[model samples]
Target: MRPARQTALEKVLPQIAIESPEAALDFPFTPEKVWLEIGFGNGDALAHWHHEFPNTGFIGCEPFINGVSNFCKLVANDDLKNIRIWNDIAQPLMAALPDASIDRVYLLNSDPWPKKRHHRRRVIQQESLDTLWRIMKPGALLILTTDHQSLAEWMLEQTLRHSKFEWTAKCKADWQTPPEGWLTTRYEGKGAVAGRSQVYLTFRKVDCE
Candidate 1:
């Protein structure tokens, strides 16, 4: 256990070392709402959003040890208090979090796992979507960006099929650029440098009966 993080995040987790998402909400909070960013590589965008929205708490989930360490490092270096982490599979983490607890989410250029057979390994599957829906508050934004066209289409199709989520793009520009102050992540900045077009998709969760 990372002693520095134990009090607020311990065994609320399963044996898998999850940071009990439920306990996260109950932690001494100063942020007005919680935002979750899945697969936050190196925490660049996480840090950006933390500074940009000082009143919003963030929980970044990344199973990769390296990424989690990098995120922790950035959190310390930047002296950010509005961030916490689940350095494990988001599935169990989401399982512990209260329903409708989250206000916003970001899935940025996630790993494609490009092989057709490896599609199941992708994070944005139906089960994940359903779980995300369960955790997000109604009308909260889910931001997804991808540089791969096929994957982007796949994401769009899945969210479009989901009854509780509404795609909110009005024009090309909505998908062309991210909102101002959006920090360039390691993956996105590289893609832009390589001249790949990026698509930004935003969805809002609808209230359920």
Candidate 2:
């Protein structure tokens, strides 16, 4: 969020243009899956997901330097090699991704951007959804997690209306439960300590019938 940090990212980050998350990965044969975590604050869930799914290549974007440093410490401690970083707005990065390329997408506990006027900044908007769908392979997952009920409902409704995405909740438990190996992030823990509820949403990309 600092001006200096923004300048640093612009200077050091590589511009690997892939056109889709699926295309961002380098492995072959297994159709190497690419999963993205936008605004990975403190990077706990991203780190855990890396260990759990070793074959999956991950791209994590966060504009916050402090959070990036916290994530770097964990990456160093864990000796992880499957993750890459982009310290800027994820939309431009998404633009570089290949169409129908990403296997799964994660947007967990993003800043609510609360005020009605500032809601435009929320990533769950139509433009964001279009960009998200453009990169995801058919049947690929788009996972959203939030403790903010209003935002959660809004995202659910908006994403559900997208012809390319299909929400996968068959029962209440699916909405209430967290995904596998979903380690608590700093925000998630704070919410829990505050007695707030968390919701997990899964949407599959649908294409070509």
Candidate 3:
């Protein structure tokens, strides 16, 4: 991490860090909604969404210290109040959240762990899906994007088989198209330049009453 970002991590992080998952939703202000982003690499999308949705509280989880530092810098520079950081793996925080707590979740261009032997490390799995379904509000959206073809397929398969989530795509174009006003991250831009196709998947939590 650069000196400035390191300083941001040391100085700014304490003001917005989520020290406890049980109090994750207790923002300074009562936000209209809460969104969680797992593995928010580089914090590009997380920061973008924070600016775009000032009324929505954001919880960004990234195990990487550099990413957390970069995001903290943004928070300090902008004086953003509706954002919180969990600088660790997301599962523990997810488990701690109350049922039907989060309004949406984002898992964008996360580490694919492409090796077959490392597939277990991939974020999209049955147990994680169960946790996500329990935490997200009914009709809440889980939005995921990936430039890796195998990872895209794996995510689709895992999310589709989950009984509590219904894929919102009606046709091929739906998944192929990015959501309106999608913010392309630096990593995603590089993937596009390298001729990699991106897949956008959205699944809605089923009410299942």
Candidate 4:
């Protein structure tokens, strides 16, 4: 972690970090809705969303220390009151959350883990989706974006294989373009500069019959 960010995290984390499942239940202010962002690299989108939805509480999980520090700096600088941080793996945090707790989730430009042997390390897998399905409220949205073609297909296939989710895209443009009010991240900007297209996929959690 950078020195400045580390210092900022030390000061702000005690106030904004969600330490346990019990804390998450009443995070920040217990707003009408809760959103989760896993692997919020550098926190540009997370901060943007928090700014846009002051009434909704946000829980952002990032295992990388640098990212966590940067995110903490944003929270401190903006004095964003409705956001909480989990500076650890998302699975444990997900497990800590109660059933039907999350209203929205963002998994954007996650590490592709391109190697075949490393595919299991990718976040958009069966187990992760199953947990997400369990925690998400009925009709809640899961928004995923990736510039890697294989990863995009993998996400689509994994989500489609799960019976709990329904794809919201009716046409190509729906996935081709970023969703309305989209907050573009640094990684997304780099992908665009490289002429690589990013896919935006939204899946709605549904009740299982």
State TM-scores per candidate.
0.85, 0.84, 0.96, 0.95
Off by over 4 Å in 3: none
The residue-by-residue lDDT of candidate 3 on 46-67, one tens digit each, is 9889999999999999999998
Q: Candidate 4 residues 1-209, lDDT tens each?
A: 67889898898888888787557756656588999999998999998888889889899988888887887787777756788888788888898788899999999999999999999999988999989999999999999999999999999999999878999999999999999888899999999999999999999998885
Clashing pairs in 3: none
Q: Sum up the clashes in candidate 3.
A: 0
- lDDT values, one for every candidate: 0.77, 0.77, 0.91, 0.89
Per-residue alpha-carbon lDDT of model 1 for 1-209, expressed as tens digits? 35543432333223223346566654345678989888887778987788788788888888776666555555554544566777766777787788898999899998887788988888788888898899999899999999998789888888888777888889989888787667778899899899998889999998875
Let me know the TM-score candidate 3 reaches against the reference structure.
0.96
Return whichever of 3 and 4 wins on lDDT. 3
Give the Cα error of residue 10 in candidate 1, in Å. Answer: 16
Where is model 4 poorest over a 10-residue stretch in terms of lDDT? 21-30
Once fitted onto the true fold, the runs of candidate 4 whose alpha carbons sit more than 4 angstroms away are none
Q: How well does candidate 1 match the true structure in TM-score terms?
A: 0.85
Write down the lDDT that model 4 would get: 0.89
Q: Give the poorly placed runs of model 2, Cα more than 4 Å off.
A: 1-31, 77-80
Scanning candidate 1 in windows of ten residues, the lowest lDDT window is 7-16
**Candidates' RMSD to native:** 4.8, 4.6, 1.1, 1.3
**Which pairs clash inside model 4?**
none
